[model samples]
Target: MADKEIAQDDQRVAVVTGGSSGIGEATARALAGDGWYVIVAARRVDRLEKIAAEIGGGAVRLDVTDDDSVAEFAARIDRVDLLVNNAGGAKGLDPVKEADLEDWQWMYETNVLGTLRVTLALRDKLVASEGLIVNMASVAALNPYAGGAGYNAAKFGLRAMTRVQRIEEATEGTNIRVTEIDPGRVKTDFSLVRFKGDRDKADAVYEGHLNLGPEDIAEAVRWVASLPAHVNIDRIHIMPRDQV
Candidate 1:
C-alpha cells in the first residue's frame, strides 16, 4: 500500500483502476507520459509497484469488487483530477439457456458494481477538482452477440450508469465531465481472461484480423482527458479497421 501525497505544485492527479495489465496499464503509462501524476490502482501489488516506479507515479492495491479494499484505497489518495473507471472485464461467453450463474455473477459484480463502488468513493474528489471520468465500456454494450450475454448485460448496465451520471452531473452543475469509451476489439489479455486462460480459443478471436492494441485505446483516453474542462465528449466508439 504505497500512499502518495497530493503534489505541492500544480501537477494534476489521475487515478486509474485495473492498472496492472492491458488497457489499464497502457492508460496509466500514457497519462504519465503527458505529465499527469497518475496513481495506478489494481490487485497486483508487485506489478503495480513496477509500473508506478517506471512511470514516476504511485501505486495502490485495489480490488474494485471489494468494499474494504476500495475504501482503504480511496483513503490513501488525497486528490484526483481524473478518474478512469477501467477496472473491469468479461468472464465467460455462454448462451442464455446454458448460462453459468457464477460467471454472470462475477461479470456483474466486477464490471457493474465495481465501477459503482469506485465512482461513489471518488465522487467527492472529482467534484472538488471539477474533474473528468472516463468509463471503459465496450462495443458489447451497444451490439450484443450470440455468445456474449453475460458481458453484454454487464456493459449495458455500465453504459446506463455512465449516461445517468452524466445527466445528473450536468443538472446539478457539478461541472464534472463523463465520457464512455467503447472499443470493439483489442489484442490484450482480455480474450484470454474471457476464455479462462484458454490460449488457443483466445488467439482465434484475433487470428487473422489486424486488431487494436491497448496503447491505441490508451491514446484515446489521454486525448479525452486533455480536452478543455468545458468540453465534454459524451461518448467515443473505436474499433479495428476489420472489425464492424
Candidate 2:
C-alpha cells in the first residue's frame, strides 16, 4: 500500500456547496485560481451558472436536504480533491424562547445535516482522492450570541460532527482531512437572509463596523487546502478584529 499520507503537492478537483453566494462563491474562485477544477454546487442554478462561467468550472443545482439532489450532483463528478461544506446560516434571529421551532429545525437541516448529506454521499470519492473537507461553522458555535441560539446550536453540532468524521475517516484509512471554519459576522447575504431581505435591517447590522467579507474566509479555505500533504488542519476560527 502507498503511504497513508497526503503530500501537499496533490492537485485535484473541488466541490463547494453554497457555491452560488458568499464564502462559497469566493472559495470556488480561489480554488480555481489555484488550479483546481472546481465544481460549484447549490440551490441557485442561475447564480451557479454565472459563477461556473466565470471560473471555468461546472455547476450543479443541489438541495442538500434532498437525497436525490445530492446523489445526482455527486454523479457528475468522479471524485473530489476537496469538499467545502459552506452551506449554512440562520433564517431568522428570534431568541430560542420566542423563536419559531421551524426556524431552528430549518437551520439544523442546512448547517448540520446538509453538510453531512454531501460529505457522506461523497466519502468514497474523497477517500479515493485523498482529499480534504472544510465544513463552514460559525463563531456562534463557540461563543453563542443573545439571539443566536438556534443558529449557534446548529454550528456547534456541525463542529462536533466534523471532529467525529475526521476520527472515523482517518482510522478507516481514508486519509481524508476534515476541518471546520468558524467565522464571525461576515458581511454577505447572511444578515439579509436572516432578516428576510430587509435592506435597512440587514444594513444596520454592519453599519457601525466593517464586518468580515466573503473573500476573507475564502482565502482561509484556500490556505488550508494548499498545505503540504500529511498536514490535516482541524479547525479554523477567524473573525474581524473588532468582533468579540
Candidate 3:
C-alpha cells in the first residue's frame, strides 16, 4: 500500500526506526500483524523495502544521526500512533581507561543523539496523535559491567531521556505514553556490529548460554503498544532465564 493510502485509513500508524533487521524488523512484522499501518525506516532501503512489502506497509530511508535525513523521514508520515526508537546499538567492549574515543562517539551519536533527533522531528505528530514512544534500551543501562563503558553510558543516557520524556508529556497534557524496554542479551547482529564484524567474537557472546531472540523483545513491544492509552507501562526489564 502507498504511504498516502495508509495515512488516509483509520488504522493506527506506527513508525519503527532501524526496521531493517533484528528486533526492529520483528516489531514491524508483529505490529502489522496486529493491524497497525507500519512504516519501517532504516538506511538500508533494500532491506526496509523487503520488510515493508512482506508486511504490506511502507518503507522510508532514515539515518537517525542526520538532521536532514530525520526531517525528511518525518515529513513523509502523516500520523503516528506509535514510535519505536530502535536504531541504537553498541560499538565496542573496552574498559573506561582503554576506551576507544571513536567508538564512544559512535555509540553516543547513534544510541543517544539519534533517538533525540528522530523524536524531536516527530514530536508534533506524536502530540497530535497522543502517541506512545517506546525506547529500546539495554540492561546495561541499569547494570554496568566491565568492558561495557561506552554502551552503559549511552543506554544510561537513553534511560534518563525516556524518564524525562514521560514526565514532560504528562505535565504538558499531551497524553503521550512513554516506555523503555531494557533487554538482557538478545541474540542478534548486536555483538557482530559491536565486534566490528568478527564472526567468532560475535558467536561467543551467546554461545552455550540461554539468550533471548529478537522476537522476545518484539513481543514486549507489541504488548506495550496493545495496552489502553490510559494504562502506561513505565519500564520493562526483560532477561533470559539464565542471564541473572
Winner by lDDT: 1
**Winning candidate number (TM-score):** 1
TM-score to true structure, per model: 0.98, 0.93, 0.97
Give the per-residue lDDT digits (tens) of candidate 3, residues 33-84.
9999899999999999999989999999999989999888887888889999
lDDT at 134 for candidate 1? 95
Point out the higher-scoring one by lDDT: 1 or 3: 1
Rank all candidate structures by their TM-score, best first, as comma-separated numbers.
1, 3, 2
Better of 1 and 3 by TM-score: 1
lDDT, candidate 2, 120-216, per-residue tens: 8988888888889999998888998788889889989998898899899889887888888899889998999889889999999999996899999
Per residue, candidate 1 scores C-alpha lDDT tens digits across 124-178 of 9999999999999999999999989999999999999999999999999999999
The local distance difference test score of each candidate is: 0.94, 0.87, 0.93
Query: What lDDT score goes with residue 28 in model 2?
Result: 96
The predictions' CA RMSDs to the true structure, in order, are 1.1, 5.1, 1.7
RMSD of 2: 5.1
